[model samples]
Target: MDPLHDLTSHDLRVRHAMEYEYRRGTNPSVAAININQAYPKAVSERTCQRWWKRWQEEGVDVEDKERPGFQSKVDNEELRDLIEMNPRFSSEEIGEILGVDSSTIRRHLKAIGKKYVSSVWVPHDLTPQQKAKRVNTCKDLLSLQDSDPFIRWMVTGDEKLIYYVNDSKKSEWRSPGQRPVGRPRPDFRQQKVMLSVWWDKSGIIHWELLEVGATISAEVYCQQLTRLREKLKENRKSLVNHWGVNFHQDNAPSHTAKMTQNLLKDFGWKIIPHPPYSPDIAPSDYYLFRSMQHFLDGKKFKNREEVEVAVKEFFGLKEKNWFAEGIEKLPNKWREVIELDGDYIIN
Candidate 1:
């Protein structure tokens, strides 16, 4: 029988198997010519040579190697539909739905110009009216700042919990491939003190570490205001004399209670209107406390007195400009909140 007639009679799989056997004994050129003799659509001699080289390098398998590319399980349209169903679904969750790994989901999502980030934490899910109130308040404050040294006249205060264990101990030296030594987990039951403070653009006017087991109530808050009044007389007499006072505080129940409002009225101080759930606009929260928290990082306190001493030292070390800057940040933040349409001003 003619070799070309026999080649065309059988399939390529049988011929390829014969080629491998031929390559084991004869050269690739001989195998190529032999494969062509029997096959109708003959593979080139170069193709046979390439297959022989691959077999030598990567086992005796004749199948083609897997090529490199994105190789995603879910296509663009499928992913778009999945995201449209729920934009907030995590990559892991989406991966489960699409039968792919989270990393694959992330890669595909990125290819389609999608990203994942943390949701900003805010005190409340603001209503449309509440958002409008924030915008109006910010615009009013900005207007006030343009005409007056509003920051200097402002008396802002807030309470913060200073923990005994503030150290993050986030790093430790370890030999390569060895587990890093970690600090002890923070004790939730550790002793902590609440530091209630009042300040202006000048600096800290007054601060008190609340007594153990004593939380601030309307009565306690009222008494603190009375103390704050005395402190203003002593430390900020000039400011008080010139601008009276513009008290700025969150709408805590204790702060907005009838007694608190009456106390401000009686003292002849003006209560600056603060929007509800708007701590991002508060100087104490967005600026002062942020700085204090940074300073307190990696610090461990033994007792309340140590914490107090540290707190006082931290306050004393700050320059007058630092306090001024903290208050100065407020107007910008207010404007940002307005620009964001009452959303929290996240850094």
Candidate 2:
């Protein structure tokens, strides 16, 4: 071998110096120190010991031998094209196509910034027209808000299923080697009741816990609206007399039915336009129900009355500002919908 000083490759110099040190019966630690002094971080003592052991057991070679395996070569362009064509393809699937090991495929995919993530489920695969409508509606709402600032007077309502049992898997503190606590799988047939609730910036105005298995129809929804109006008269008399009611509800079949519309007109409430498949912008869906779920977590109710008590407790715990904050998010959500070109707001 050429003199270590004459070796052009830094790796070759390190190997050659290790070999020289082995020939001279120098210890690996000393050999590593000498090599690092010469080349600065050329190799660690452990690496020198490994090379010395290899040379003593097998042989010495200044250059690295080809690693013994089927060398996997991935064509990055081909891999990228395959992923672009079908992002859902698994590492094993791509490996089969590329004639490489799945592990190799995973490493390469990671190198190219590919990550396996579950697809986010959207409310709808909106058509271009639907997207345009969402954008236009949001813009109009923003305009209405700027002119009227009527969100404070707006009353929003929606129905949610209140499960009798709301247990969920949760993490627990345990000894390191101990197995995690297990939870039973969720029961799809668990008893639940429909909770129809209406609220404004002030707080909940009206709420009802329907009987088990009762679903809202157009007639039922219209009756609920009448009840909601009566509640508003009792609780929010000032809002009804001064600002009137700016009602907001999703475009459910019952909510959009002719009877429902006629009832709203008779009550003289201004119906705020809510685009279809837009729970992201709805105060009840995004804010109120989300907080209620947190409150209901791990709770169990034996009867409808127990569930009703829990619901009332949840509502009563929230202050007036909390309800106001929920309604306050509407204009910003509307702006976001327009800014995102009608894409659902992730947060």
Candidate 3:
């Protein structure tokens, strides 16, 4: 390649040398050899000098090498959809499916808005009905928010169990310079015992330590309601004065028990209309208890006592606003679920 192709400051010196030699009228062979190390015969001294001056004026980087090869593996759109499908997949796994290197996957992902967020279970494919339900639920929740807003009189609560087995596998470092090891433990929910957690904007005022887990009995659920009433009474001087005490629970058989229904009617606790088989509508399902489960992951407690403490600590640390935020979402969601004719997804 002719050195003049670059037209750098150094090339200017060569050009000037060639010109001086040309003017001196040296042997054509010697002149050609001298120029051969720098420029071609077709390159005039003036042109070389101009290019050299341009290079000196504007210090530019070497142009990058040509792109090396064809793209391997998945297309950008396909990779994006797959990432959207499941955020938990690492680049290596994505590459394997797409038939490309992990680096290719990483490049594609970075191009989109996806960041290396904590692994998320990007939900499984939902049916058309499922997607519609979810969207409608949001609409209802928003409507509910607009109607009542907040008065502190209306408090919502739900009961759930925090299991003993650490239901989550976590990455830990045993030594330096080694890749962190993740405990790949499947979700081991100990259905034998469950904690009944019910809290409002105030805090976790009532909870039940359930001995039976598989299917909650009507009597057991009624007992939970009874305890919940008693606990709420303890918080306030008179249940009568707090007239807005709305007992919100799902259609667990016990909640719909003949005796329990009578008791709620007698107590004058407003029963928020709860839809059947609707775990999505519950705040505990969406916001509050997810944190509790996450904390319980990768932890082990042999006895009920240790499990109780962990459960207590988990709820105790949550901010008051977090609970309120969940409750606040309910009214609008309820209105929406009702409007969708009972077919809205609540997440």
Candidate 4:
């Protein structure tokens, strides 16, 4: 019997007690004495007498009480499935999928000795370097790991590709049973423009617009450097030499190609490259695209030009600091990301 569920255990014991009492009531004194042989563990005559009187007073529920604690949010089987699915999913993500809170997730995980993973959703457009930069930057920024003393700085940027879907800001997939029938699903594939920018804490941005559906060539890459050169000037004049401003970029062919180096030399720029295969680090990989995607949900455009205009409008509305705030998460997360360096973080 479950010791924690008083009603079930009490009902069982009392039913047995009633049968014993009824048998004793019908038997001769010799048999009655024999029935007295039925006793609780270590119970003598006096203890049995006390127990019998207590049962008489309380009815069949001799040991009835409330259930001991909260019911478990996740059971062993589900926990095992989640651990199998992704050993890295945090308490929060597991809880989200299970419709429980993170504490419950942690409780189950701890009980099973399972580690937690993050549940962050990522868009498909980020490059590997963008991914790493975002994770490491956020980690360092959160942990306040400013090894450079008072004049704190960090660079964050992502190459943005605009599609018709990019205008529809936010869209959610309905549950299987809730999907509409008869009509075909909307088509999302199409040609669109790509734009990229290199930005820093001081609010300067060097941006480029690219023609979509074509491989970016050395000439196009050189054009982007031309834009960067103009943007980096103090009064649209000379370039800063040896003045360290960390340049962040995704691993797009244009960003890493030899063409990029020739231009960087001509107009000096400090570049810090992030590791490949991690998107959780790119600020725009998370921030700009999210904001833009939310804006694009359910909207339709006549053409790619219309889509590009919509994107500019969407980004234009966002105040500059909206992007600036991404840098604030530094310092606190320094140790966590550094310790697990090059790994994806989903916070």
Candidate 5:
């Protein structure tokens, strides 16, 4: 027959020629080279070797065969479009739309660089003005740190809800073929207490566990500040008398209330500017509370007294350097916030 011109005919002709060469004991490399010299598009030596191995093991049939339940070609563009439209679509859902098996869809999705992950939780959806304010505030703080290193004189504090029972699920070592150990589901409405804590570069300055059914009003917050001032006089007298205190706290209703502001002015402490909805930049949120949460995990507390003891123990175990390390991270965090254009520092 005249040498085939169209692609399919040419492909079959080349395969038949390869079979002929194989039967005649021609080497795969030599056959591939010879075929390329005679054909339009070249086939690789690896392809020739693969066909030879298949012929020896499974018996050769050059004609394309339909797989049992798999498709030979998937419209990758359509698949990409579907994923771009709604990334939450599962493999099965994509498969249904693409008329393929879920396994096939999964393989294709991976090939196209798609991944499924849980969304990161942020404190708030920041508007453009909020993001700009975060960036500008961080810049101003960085400039202030450059002029005078006031981090050592800074006193930062925040309040957190401490649960009576903290349940954490952790991984464990197990024998091969053994199922993982299961843990009971956590209760959503477990009893909890409010813990207000203050710290500086040195260590814990003051802390309190509030009574049940009590909240920190502006008056109450001022009382706490007053107590904190006395604690500073006792624990950090030099900071109070000489270097002075740079107070840091969130803009909660109580902390920013008129009475609270007046009290802070009366004490003559400089208040650090904290951007709204920016827990990521707060030392207590990103550092102190993060470590405290880890310590509290898997622990069971009977009452406010037990929780208070645990909180004290947690602070007692931490070294002075550890507290300083957290305080020192402030500058780097400010730079990072600026670098990210006010995005929350997830790390």
Candidate 6:
């Protein structure tokens, strides 16, 4: 064998080099020795001999042989129909139904432009009749606004429960691989307060903490409406005289009770026609309460008094324009409800 040998490994380039050496009159042992000298990681003499024989017989190719396996059963039409029937199905669940691997199902899902996502939360599942009612009512309100602009006269109110502690359970910035921080467990028996508030475009008309242990029944609601009327007369006397109170509230049991309806007539306040199951369009639920929830995101209160103070402060901190904007959005929301053909608008 020649002392000056080159390495020829089990690779296309190495095999080609060996072939070149053999064709140039170098012996096989000399070619192998030369290749091993040059490349410490070169294949053994036996591997070179085998590849060299193959090159002579079938030519040189480095790629592996073709692989074989079972074909997929996830057809485009079937997968699309499955997703249309149930958008909430998981990859694993779909795999089980279709007799395929979850990974394969995921691939097909992406190919068909399908994705798993959280469903939006709507306040109510309205019936077709209720939806038609919403459309008709919103159309009526929009028509009225064109001539009267009664949106400015609207005084909407609602009640919400405020707990002693507000924990958003939001994530925080942390080092990689560390466990996420947990929120402190609030006392199961912690104190809570019910806030009943009324407001118009200009600002808050009246808000009160319901007497301890007193839920708002029809009688209590009527009394609150009377107080709201007095507050309106004081703060917005001229507007009230002009519009005579376009009161807007949800169809709660107490609110829709015959006694509550009769009391509004006695107080001479005009009740706005609010369609049932339409809290998404109400200014109190969609606008004011949402803003308040953001303001009270992580606050903690020891008692109802502190919660009241915070609530009052939140109302006071807002400019008159803030209230006006909230009220003005009502017309747009009404239009949206109509545009959606009576479906609940997700904020």
Q: TM-score winner among the candidates?
A: 2
lDDT of 4 by residue, 73-182 (tens): 57769867765533434454456466665456555655664432222222223445654665666555444445553213455666654544323212332211121233
How many steric overlaps are in each model, in order? 1, 0, 10, 38, 0, 6
Better of 1 and 3 by TM-score: 1
lDDT of 5 by residue, 1-347 (tens): 11111333556677888888788888988988887787744466777897888789877777544435657567889887775444434565566456575556655766775544221112334678888999999999999999998887999998876777677645443211123465543332346677899999999999998896466789999999999999999999899999999999987778899999999999999999999767778899888887988899899877778988899899989999999999999999999989989876765
Question: Which stretches of model 5 miss by more than 4 angstroms?
Answer: 1-124, 171-190
* Model 1: lowest-lDDT 10 consecutive positions: 115-124
Please give each candidate's TM-score. Answer: 0.61, 0.63, 0.51, 0.50, 0.62, 0.61
Q: Which residue pairs in candidate 5 collide? A: none
Give the Cα error of residue 172 in candidate 5, in Å.
9.7
Off by over 4 Å in 2: 1-124, 169-182
| Candidate 2, run of 10 with poorest lDDT | 1-10
Candidate 6 structure quality by residue, lDDT tens digits, 115-137: 43222122224678888999999
Alpha-carbon RMSD, candidate 3: 18.4
* lDDT (0 to 1) per candidate: 0.70, 0.76, 0.56, 0.50, 0.76, 0.70
Query: What would the per-residue lDDT of candidate 1 be over residues 52-109, giving only the tens digit for each residue?
Result: 6766787666433322442457787998776644443456556656666555776577
257-307 in candidate 3: lDDT tens per residue? 898888788778776554444655766666666677688877777767787
lDDT of 6 at 32: 76
After TM-score superposition, the amount by which residue 129's alpha carbon in candidate 2 deviates from its true location, in angstroms, is: 1.3
Question: What are the per-residue Cα lDDT tens digits for candidate 2 across 63-175?
Answer: 54433452488998998887654443456557756667655776677677555422111223467887889899999999999998999799999988777777753544331
What lDDT is reached at residue 119 by model 6? 23
Q: Is candidate 1 or candidate 6 better by lDDT?
A: 1
Better model by lDDT, 3 or 5?
5
In what order do the candidates fall by lDDT, top score first? 2, 5, 1, 6, 3, 4
